[model samples]
Target chain A: MSNTPNRNRQLRSKLGRVRGLGSSHEGVHHWWAQRMSAMALLPLSLWFIFSLISLTGSDYVAFQSWVSEFGNSVFLVLFLVSMFHHAQLGLQVVIEDYVHSELWKMGLLLIVKYGSVLFAASGIFAVLKISLAG
Target chain B: MAEDDRPLSPHLQVYRPQITSVLSITHRATGVFLSLAAVMLTYWLASAAYGPDSFARAQAALESWFGRLILFGFTFSLFFHMCNGIRHLGWDLGWGFDLVKLRMTGVLVIISAFGLTVLSWVMAYSHVGKL
Candidate 1:
């Protein structure tokens, strides 16, 4: 919804004045990306959970070798990136909705973006390091 | 519509509690939870990669009473979000837009989340002897 408190009537077109009442253009992209990641995560998350379950009673070597497999390692990175990116997008919206102050909103947005990226990078790095250790 | 007196949609307080509103809000809440849990997930992965000493510490934390409690919460949240997220993706494809189907799938997501939590813990318990 347009939170624009004041609109300049002089610049408003006929259609714009009558019907500009939905997401800003960027929202559609965010929505699309979130759904895209969600779809990807469906299968990836199932695999991750089941794979984790398989490793439950196993040891460090079992964990290492599981991730060391080529396909597993690649998907691990994909799953981490997609999950974090999707999370950042979702949290950004939550922050936007609740935090009305422009300064606080921007600050939270930066933290969510960078923090998710940092976590994703670390997860990916860990996966890669284990897989490559062999 | 005038900004001062715009006919906005009804606020949440106007509606009775229903699956639609409940699930919608729950979806957002679980998303926030999962995002925070990702940090813990990362710790598990990174510690595992760091080798035996680090992973042993990670394992100990995970098996501890407090850690298992957190893990239990995370596990349910993960499956719930996953199931509901798939339902959302279905909506994006223009499926399950009908009221009955939406309600059906929403109920299914909740049911499955519980079913999955029980199943996962059972599976974990079965591994106790194997450990």
Candidate 2:
């Protein structure tokens, strides 16, 4: 996002493909999602830290009951979704940075994107299943 | 996409390691690590939702030395990421751009990470030895 030459080059992309990716592919969406998630996590993560602190000595029944609470379940769902979304974006940037092989890079990026979604879904499902049962 | 060999930007070999550089790079590494750790988080949640038996099994695994080590790493990484995340937000808000402030904040993040990790463990140990 900081590359002036890259932005200028991409700015020409709105006119049509001059070199490679267009302005449409400027990656602001990805950046915005990451930023938003970071903002969201600011409070959510604090809540999470306090919740875990409260659960520090809790037993299984305590944890089960705590998680079964409607508010806790809903907050957890939000946390998982935003956390995974932010994580996927971060990993995409990482793979793009270190993995020089274009094919491998693309493969890994796809895996990260899909994998985060799958895992986050599983996490949310777990939260819901427990909350519903209790 | 670049096929031609240009002079290229300076590589890691060109510069001495500093707290700023180290923390900057480790932030990415820890970010990637946390993403992978997210899988384990899912597993734990799934087990918890399953039943007492499954939760017990998961708890046993997490209580193991290997799992504890991993958890420690995860905890440390979380704190580091959190502190550095604040620093990033500062950058986004157009503050702390100066070299001195950057380096100071970098060191503070490192210290905060260790402090948080230690404090967490202490709290856990005082409460439940599970951590």
Candidate 3:
């Protein structure tokens, strides 16, 4: 209705006035993801530390048997991928702030994002294969 | 774009050295190093998944002198970065901003990094029966 149109206009104008303000939606979510992933890693990393200590003298079969467990491998894969995502985002911020050249900054960020995702996926695929084969 | 007319910001090259400055730079450098290590970890995982032969090859490399050195450095870097990152997080939460507290935390981070690295390796080595 005509009244709805007026309300929409009012809202648009209000938002427009705030449009050029300092912050963007990007930074908040990125910061949160970094923090969340770091928090997640706290427990997982502790688990991994203990597991690695246990695996220290483990023969090949023993290590494989451990990783072959569905829950452990899945969680380990999750940890690795999330860690990569968080690390990539953190590194992107570092690069953008430190690298003076705009072109290089953009290029490096793209490389980091794609490279991290690729490596994470490949690692996960490898884990899946190893676990399934066992 | 004007060569001489544009305002320029100061940089590290203009500043004298200090321990804090050095540590700050090393923190970033080690972060970059950790990124590289993550890539290697992915490779190691992929190889382990491939087969026993692949895992053996990866293990052999890790057992070599060069690999051991890299692993040692990475362990130290990991501990240092973890400690320093916690220090930063504490500051972010508004807890250690005073100069004295900042300096004390910085020293504490270094010592803790060393202590943690030693403890981890001792545990790892003992488990492997190589201690």
Candidate 4:
């Protein structure tokens, strides 16, 4: 009748009478997002590097023109999204690995994940506004 | 052989440190560095979008001595993390697991990271007139 024991019961291993219930749906969601964001980061990262190099000495007008380009803005948006999401995933793992206190770790993870999303969305909107307005 | 049935063998305390260990530690350190760096990326994008004054501030920071040092550290961390991640990807693909190969690859990643970092700085400096 105790929920605590029943919760443990759901996670039993195959060698035991039951396998411990594997990751919940939320766990799978985070894992999938991490992998997918990493995949997105791969090419976006390369593009970002090249873009930085290309824009090295360009003035404000030049940079404005660059961002105003349809393709440039599109890729830049992708890069921004992937960068923040990947950062969230990486930071979550680091926190989980090193943060010994469960409450602190959970709080930090939530702050990091939500903070990253908010920052990424704000950044993306700024970019779209600039690119579209121009 | 039954000992293999145990989940994980020989815990952390049993291991001694070495050059490879140092490099391994740096890989994770740089990873955290780059993760934080990604937040800076958001700032850069936002600043760029905010127009000239904001953008100039971002550029000014990057051009400052302290900023240059941080940028250099970031560049090194980026390359180190990338090389080490590729090594990991190789392992994930079931390649490069032999002892000799592992050591060689570890050294190779460190070397490549340094080489790429220096090369990037050289290119960046060579183009300093543009900034």
Candidate 5:
């Protein structure tokens, strides 16, 4: 058993050897998630901008009616979810890079992670409330 | 701590600002700004859900001069981040790595971001018949 493990380690590439030893064991996941969310946000963000333009000078009722529509509500929720996910991941990288002290880094990371979830939940709830109630 | 004083690889302080480097950092800075902006977005949605009175207050606050200024900044930052993000995606696909192409794309990203921001604001103001 020991020899087999040693053989496997020897066969690993230089980069592979240290793959999961870093803080986040899931390698490339953060990078991949960021890119995927970015792609999703491209169309969703465009939709949001145009929608806001159309809603220009409109009152609360106009905005509410827009959100109450099924497609609009769905897209709004999707936009919020992806936006927060991307924001959290991007902010995590920024924090990790600049915040040298492990304590501060971890503290900010926790705040961002939790704050994103909380904000996302609130946004989604609001959308659902308008869509269903109105 | 003494070991930290040892010479390290070239970092931000050592390099004269170049287009590629400047844009790269700007991408990060805009991204952070947008993250903060998401709070306002949530506030808008939540206020709308709360009630008509709350929504009116929210709209009034956002439509103020200061609010418009912030919104304009948010708009530019968002478009800049989006345009540059596309450039980054292209690089990830192993395209546009040549020095000339890199500079070209960097410039293109800036122009496109500015253009889109201007276009969106124009559409917005035109829609409301006030600019």
Candidate 6:
């Protein structure tokens, strides 16, 4: 009895068991993160847009001074991080849906993931540089 | 590639385009566009951080007619995505699932998206006294 495979466990084909090509069990996490980041982005994005509108007609110095404010720097960093995270998740779904070729899907996913992180980091670094160095 | 000959799942081409379907695809399309537009945002920030000369160059490029067009599109896409995203969130909570509600909200999303985009641009141009 102890050695017997459970009926449910025995239902899977041997190849299916070996391949493990089923739900990753992480889909819920992905879904939750996408929604959470999107929620964060709503307010952050609205604020950022209004701020940009306010900064219109302002010169480089004006923009720099705006970013140099402590609150502005913090919000900018938060916005960048959330925006990239949300964008990457959304793009991943898009590529996975449209790109049937396995190679293309994986390649595009990697590009979006890495590209998002790189851009987020660059934006954050720029914000910090302007805020702290000046 | 499969040897099977069976009816396939209905895809985009199979169904006649409707407002619901159009808005659904547009949500995704705008999302993809916004992802690419993020590069410009990063460029703007980095250039500003570097120095005034670089920032000026970035500004000039962004102020060009072509750049304004792209920016206008970006603005519209952002608002559309944001508005539709809220509708999605409502659906996630099991609200607004009825056909009537769905159509109403869908139209609302489109109207609000365009209204906000135009309003934002108006505010921007007015701020610069360019309108």
Best by lDDT: 5
Deviation from native of the Cα of residue B43 in model 5, angstroms: 0.5
Which stretches in model 5 have alpha-carbon errors above 4 Å? A1-24, B1-11
* Cα-based lDDT for every prediction: 0.85, 0.84, 0.78, 0.77, 0.91, 0.90
lDDT digits (tens) for residues B1-131 of candidate 5: 57446554347877999999999999999999999788889999999999999999999999999999888888999999999999999999999999999999999999998998999999999999997
lDDT of 6 by residue, A1-134 (tens): 37676755565567656775445634367888999998998999899889989998889888989999989999999999999999999999888777777789899999999999999999999999988877
Q: What's the DockQ for every one of the candidates?
A: 0.52, 0.61, 0.42, 0.40, 0.69, 0.62
lDDT of 1 at B79: 91
Model 1 clash count equals 0
Q: lDDT tens string, model 2, B1-131?
A: 55535343346667899887788889988988888677887898999998989998988898899988998898888889989999998998999999999999998999999998888777777666555
Q: Is candidate 2 or candidate 6 better by lDDT?
A: 6
Could you report the Cα RMSD, in angstroms, for every candidate shown? 6.1, 5.2, 6.2, 7.1, 4.1, 4.7
Arrange candidates, best lDDT first. Answer: 5, 6, 1, 2, 3, 4
TM-score, first chain, each model: 0.81, 0.82, 0.81, 0.76, 0.84, 0.82
User: Candidate 1's residue-wise lDDT over B3-116, tens digit each?
Assistant: 435543346687898998898888889899999788888898999888989998999988899988988888899998988888887887899999999999999999999999
Score candidate 6 by DockQ: 0.62
Deviating ranges (above 4 Å) for candidate 4 = A1-35, B1-15, B129-131
Deviation in Å, model 3, residue A69 alpha carbon: 2.4
Which of 1 and 2 is the better model by lDDT? 1
DockQ-derived CAPRI band for the predicted complex in model 1: medium
Stretch of 10 with least lDDT, candidate 5 chain A: A3-12
- Model 6 ranges with Cα > 4 A deviation: A1-22, B1-10
TM-score of each: 0.84, 0.86, 0.84, 0.80, 0.90, 0.89
Q: What local lDDT does model 2 show for residue B62?
A: 87
- Candidate 6 per-residue lDDT over residues B7-113, each given as its tens digit: 33347887899989999999999999998778889989999999999999999998999988999999999999999999999999999999999999999999999
lDDT, candidate 4, B1-131, per-residue tens: 56325454234456897656767778778978986677777787688788889999998997799988887898888888878877876776799888888899999998999998887777765676632
TM-score of chain B of each: 0.82, 0.88, 0.89, 0.83, 0.90, 0.91
**lDDT of model 2, residue B64:** 90
